[model samples]
Target: MIPKLPGLGPLAALLLAAALSAWLGIAGPISIEGLYRWQNLLAAFAALAAAAIAYTAAMAKVKLDRQISDEQLMRRSLAILLKVEFAIQVLRQEARELEEKLGDWKNKSFKTVDLAISEPKEILEAWETLDLFPGDLILALRTLRASLVLYRTDLAKFDSQVEWESTTLASIKANPTSRASVAAKLLIQQSTDTITALRATITRLTNLLNRA
Candidate 1:
């Protein structure tokens, strides 16, 4: 592979300079005449080579640092993407559960029942507290909110129908009339269907939120 340097840049330069100076002194003639001729020329050439080597070593270190920085950035980016993927998966699962619950509710009858008896406020609060309930989960939350409102409205309507049925049933009991009883039964059936549909809508919204 690549040759490794013990030190880089300024350190490498100082080392090379010291080594070259030592080599020249050991090899060159000590006489003043020889120092002014070939001895001086040889020392000059050795110094130039050492300087070139030092410059090359310093550039290699710079390149290595840049490579390390790039790798670190890539790793950080991958970690963030993984976290986002996990969040999406969690949202999807919760939405699916909500949908399933809605489907079950659709088959139920609640003509004389008060939806408030279920006290879904606590459930709503729990849903709101989920990690993905706001911001990115806004669309999912809105769907669930609409379903909750519909359920509340249907519950109110069911209560009114129950009151009307109670009055009609009393009248029928006093007069023993079949017509009033039949009319009351029809109203009850319609109210039951409305309540069931409302519950189904809510369940569907919950499922969507879970899946989101």
Candidate 2:
């Protein structure tokens, strides 16, 4: 019957046998030819085992690198999404503040809308470069970007009109009954209306970005 070797798997048992044969041949007065034969066999098995372990380690490293790369891409994509969302939120607050100023035109001059609204620069750049986000996220960002462009264009037009009308508004406090003063009041009312419309659109865009 084969001898029982507790806790020794097949590979472990083969290595043990090879090591025992080498020890006995070298140190127990075996023949020189016998020792040489055992040494050759042991060297061959050791080389094969080393090569197998190396191949397995190389494959595992490759798989780990791929997984890490995927994780990094995902994290970058999420960061871009959050940044864009934050920018849109800032724009919304600026719009709301301007909306409140419209109620007190007596103290406030008919100045241009603050066109410093944050744009989706980073997210759009990522879309152009990596296209890292999923399809739905890409679609949402595209729509948001277009909306911001249109809003900016509308603001430019309003600012141009305000510049042209500002001259008549200068004397409105001194001579409220004059034609220029009446026209200035009319222009202020128009500006208020424009601000309301812009705020509505900005609110809609904020809601859309929030959903993302």
Estimate, for each residue in 10-97, the C-alpha lDDT of model 1 and write its tens digit: 5555765686578678986366675666666567666766777777778889999887775554444333333433443343344344
TM-score, predicted candidate 1 vs. hidden true structure: 0.34
Q: Stretches of candidate 2 above 4 Å error?
A: 1-44, 98-130, 157-212
TM per prediction: 0.34, 0.47
Error of 1 at 123 (Å): 26
For each candidate, what is the lDDT? 0.44, 0.51
- Backbone clashes for every candidate come to 12, 0
Scanning candidate 2 in windows of ten residues, the lowest lDDT window is 175-184
RMSD of each: 16.0, 13.0
User: How many clashes would you count in candidate 1?
Assistant: 12
Return the clash pairs for model 2, or none.
Answer: none
